[model samples]
Target chain A: MATINDVAKRANVGRGTVSRVINNEPFVSEETRKKVLKAIEELNYHPSSFARGLASQNSYTIGVIMDNTMDKVYANPFIYEVFRGVEKSVYEGGYNLLLLGKNTYQNGKLAVERVLQGKMVDGLILQEQIIDSEYFKNIEQYNIPIVSIGKLENRDDISWIDIDNHMAGYMAAEYLYSRGYKKIAFEGVELEKIFARERYEGYKEFIGSKGLSVMEANELLQNIEGVICLDNIYAYKILQRCKKINKKVPEEIGIITFDNYPLAEYLQPSVTNIEIDLFQLGLCAGSEMLNKLRNRNCEVNRIRIPVSVNIRETTR
Target chain B: MATINDVAKRANVGRGTVSRVINNEPFVSEETRKKVLKAIEELNYHPSSFARGLASQNSYTIGVIMDNTMDKVYANPFIYEVFRGVEKSVYEGGYNLLLLGKNTYQNGKLAVERVLQGKMVDGLILQEQIIDSEYFKNIEQYNIPIVSIGKLENRDDISWIDIDNHMAGYMAAEYLYSRGYKKIAFEGVELEKIFARERYEGYKEFIGSKGLSVMEANELLQNIEGVICLDNIYAYKILQRCKKINKKVPEEIGIITFDNYPLAEYLQPSVTNIEIDLFQLGLCAGSEMLNKLRNRNCEVNRIRIPVSVNIRETTR
Candidate 1:
């Protein structure tokens, strides 16, 4: 219920002084600033965000653009963890988060246009795996700072944070091969996805270097000793297929997957997985976006997050 | 890239007229509205959201207040599903979603005050199980409409949507009992939660009515034949405990749980569960909130979503 007038009266300053203090403008003296802050604390006066935004020409809010549909995003727990990470960083930076999705608007163009033209958010964090060059062209015209969560194609203008998927796959294959498994297979969906494809290529490279042929479905009869699953869902499907064929896990076959999902631990034979810190990925993207928004000369342009393998029951 | 001037020129109207049309202000004739609409569509001039918000006094944005910490919300798949439903409904209504959390701010009070006093969002959807009365009082003081996802303790002024936990529990108990399992146990977490307590109470009522004693942990030694888990996570834990004790699933024990999580189908014995339509629950809450925001005298105040039983391998 307290207003700017009350704060000004308590702090013994004009309304404009209080406004400047609230907006963090560098005109007020230290003593005056301290007095105004104390008065604000005492009055418990929360300024209207609209007024603050209009005065400062900044909303103190970050916009998160999710490229995936609601169903896909919700179904994959990875996205949730990433969002949580981004949210934590944004909150710590004293900024609000606005979720903008392509599926939320009539088309992807509209979604991008809304964010670019809104002039409501200070920065943007994009979580699109495959970036459209045309969309980036539109975003480039704006002065808004952006950070992508995954590697974007044909974009060197903005920063991005992602894990080394190829390294993850190479390590997964090497771990299985080191455990005395000769026949190894890679299971994945959406071969067109950059991450999935990179992982598969890495697995193939490791297998080829070891002078071992990649096991195909027909070769399952000849004993596929190890399977590198692209993700937890694929790992579960592989387990189901093994169960159907009466192939005992860990005893006759070993499995390693990406993204250590919660269900992985609860499965009968807990899955071994390459744990890419999804929350950390989100946090890094958010932090980078904040950095860019604060300092246009931010030096860090690209960041690669590391991945660790969680050795569980499935990998013996 | 299209400007308001272009739209006005194309529509043969003044810039102010174009602005009024975009803001949906009255006094613009029907024929003029059509011309402006056509012009806007052709030119693809997306107005600045800040300008639109200032002019219309509505942001067309909904704030989702979460009581849980970011980590907790991210870990729970049920929350994700509910969020998906809310997102779907909000998107269909052409509104953006802003996520605000207690942990995001210094405290719950600050979080509530920020959302209520910010004047940045049109309405709010609260997902907290236990809301503070003081916070609700503050929210009530504001003209902002609110919709709670769960049942609140004291206040009935705001609308809420939730599943019939009592009925869900009763049905679970009936199913286990009908399977000729005399020794039945109820497993739950967070007894403080209303839904959990209601479920436990329902299970107890059914057992007492049948003249059977509720089995305790010590009673498990005397052959507890069936276990009704409060949720999927507890169900996973129960299975782990059973495995540790060398009790084979289904043949020696049967289990049923709430929330048919994705892992439930992939679990070794494939958990039987009470399938609460979490998505539908979210959809109803979101739609109801939108209706209330548009119409002050919304007919529906409280909505109870239905639940069904998914008979899987564990309940045989």
Candidate 2:
């Protein structure tokens, strides 16, 4: 219940000095700043978000524009994991986070207007599904520092962070090939999935360069020894098919899958997987956004959190 | 990019009138308000967060005070489910959400000061773990309208929403008893968990009133026919113990558990469970907060979403 007057009186300074300290404007001496902070802590003085913003014009908040719908965000745990990451780092970085959206949802981009025009936030961390020319222009016009969660292609106007999908795919195949599997095949996913396609291209590029035929699971009868699956469910089905065909896994077939194979360890032949740390992706994006805010002249940075392989009995 | 002057000029009103319309003051005539809105739509002028707040003094934002640590939120999907519910409804209701927390994270309560002192949010949604006497007194001083996610016993100064744990337990026992199981037992959970204790108390009260003795899972050898587990893993363990003891399931030994038995359907005999929709809890909390905001004189509301039973093979 203490007022600014009380803090000013206790600190032996005028009201203007206390207001300046609270607003974070320069000109107060170190001694005066300490006295004001000490008074604030002792008296439990607090200021409103708008009161501070009115004078300093800094909201000291960040906005996350989730360009995906609620359905997609709910279906994918990765988004929440990313949120967990972004929230932790940014909360640690001394900024509030505003999840930008309107009451009547309109694909998410419409939510950007309020945040941009209101000066509601210091910066933004975007989880955009696609970056078309128009969408990119809308964001660019704001001229604020932004860090995109997923990878953006061909432009370095702002920073972006994602896992190296091609590298992950290449490594999955290389790991299998290195384990004495002569005929390694890649399983199928919908060709249009952006991340999956990038990984598939990586696997294909590796297989093609090595003169290996692009094969599916059904072709295990054609003497295929290893099958790397982009999807975990596909891996399990292949495992089931291998069992029905009387092929002994590891001895005759080897399987490796991407992460999030629920109860993957419970399978008769437990599946090995490439684990991409989504939390780390969010963490890097958060800190990167923080870095941009701290240094206005910093160059556009490109970051990719590395993936690790969890080896299990499927490749044993 | 349109300025207030441009919108005012377009509407044939002075800058002050346009500002007044944007500030949402009631003094503006309905006709003038309509003109300003139309001009704003045509010009797409956005008032900054501070500009609107300078006169109206409302932030138009709500604060979600997650009193638990980041780790707990990450561990419990229920928390995130509630968040998704709260976020979806509130966003649809046209209020932005501020997840308030400090940089160092002195737990979640420390973040409340800024939101409370600054009038950063119009109301609050709390996901608290423990409500000690003194800890709550600090919050009570703020006098903001609050909606707590879990049940609050004996205090109705504000509002609280949760599943009816006692009813859920009573229903589970009644279901088993009505299904012709003469001997039933309740499994164990840590004694300190509040919700679990209430549920167990309900089950015990039902059984005691019915003249049946309280029994544990291992007591099944002595003619205990059905076991209701508070935890899913415990239920799975009991299922495994029955298997090892050569007891047939559903035919000779029936079992049931609470929801979130991940892949429960994949078991030999799928487990039956009482499903509590956490998202519903959040939705009610959000709408309740919105109701409180819309009507200052509204009564303190108590809401409990009912639980649904998933009848599977384990209880067949």
TM-score of each: 0.81, 0.80
Residue pairs clashing, model 1: none
Summarize candidate 2's per-residue lDDT along B45-109 as a digit string, tens digits.
77766766755777878887654345423245456567767876777676777875322241243
Per-residue CA lDDT of model 2 for A1-316, tens digit only, reads: 6778999999999999999997688999999999999999899887656766867878878887654345433355446667667876777776777875322342243656656667888898875464555665776777888888877765678789988888888888888888888688888756776678877887887788888877766644557989888766677678767877888888888888876533345444568888888878887888998898889889998887788788988886
In candidate 1, what are the lDDT values of residues A291-315, reduced to their tens digit? 9988988775878888888899887
Compute fnat per model.
0.38, 0.40
Which pairs of residues collide in candidate 2? A47-B118, A48-B118, A103-B91, A103-B92, A118-B48
DockQ of each: 0.36, 0.34
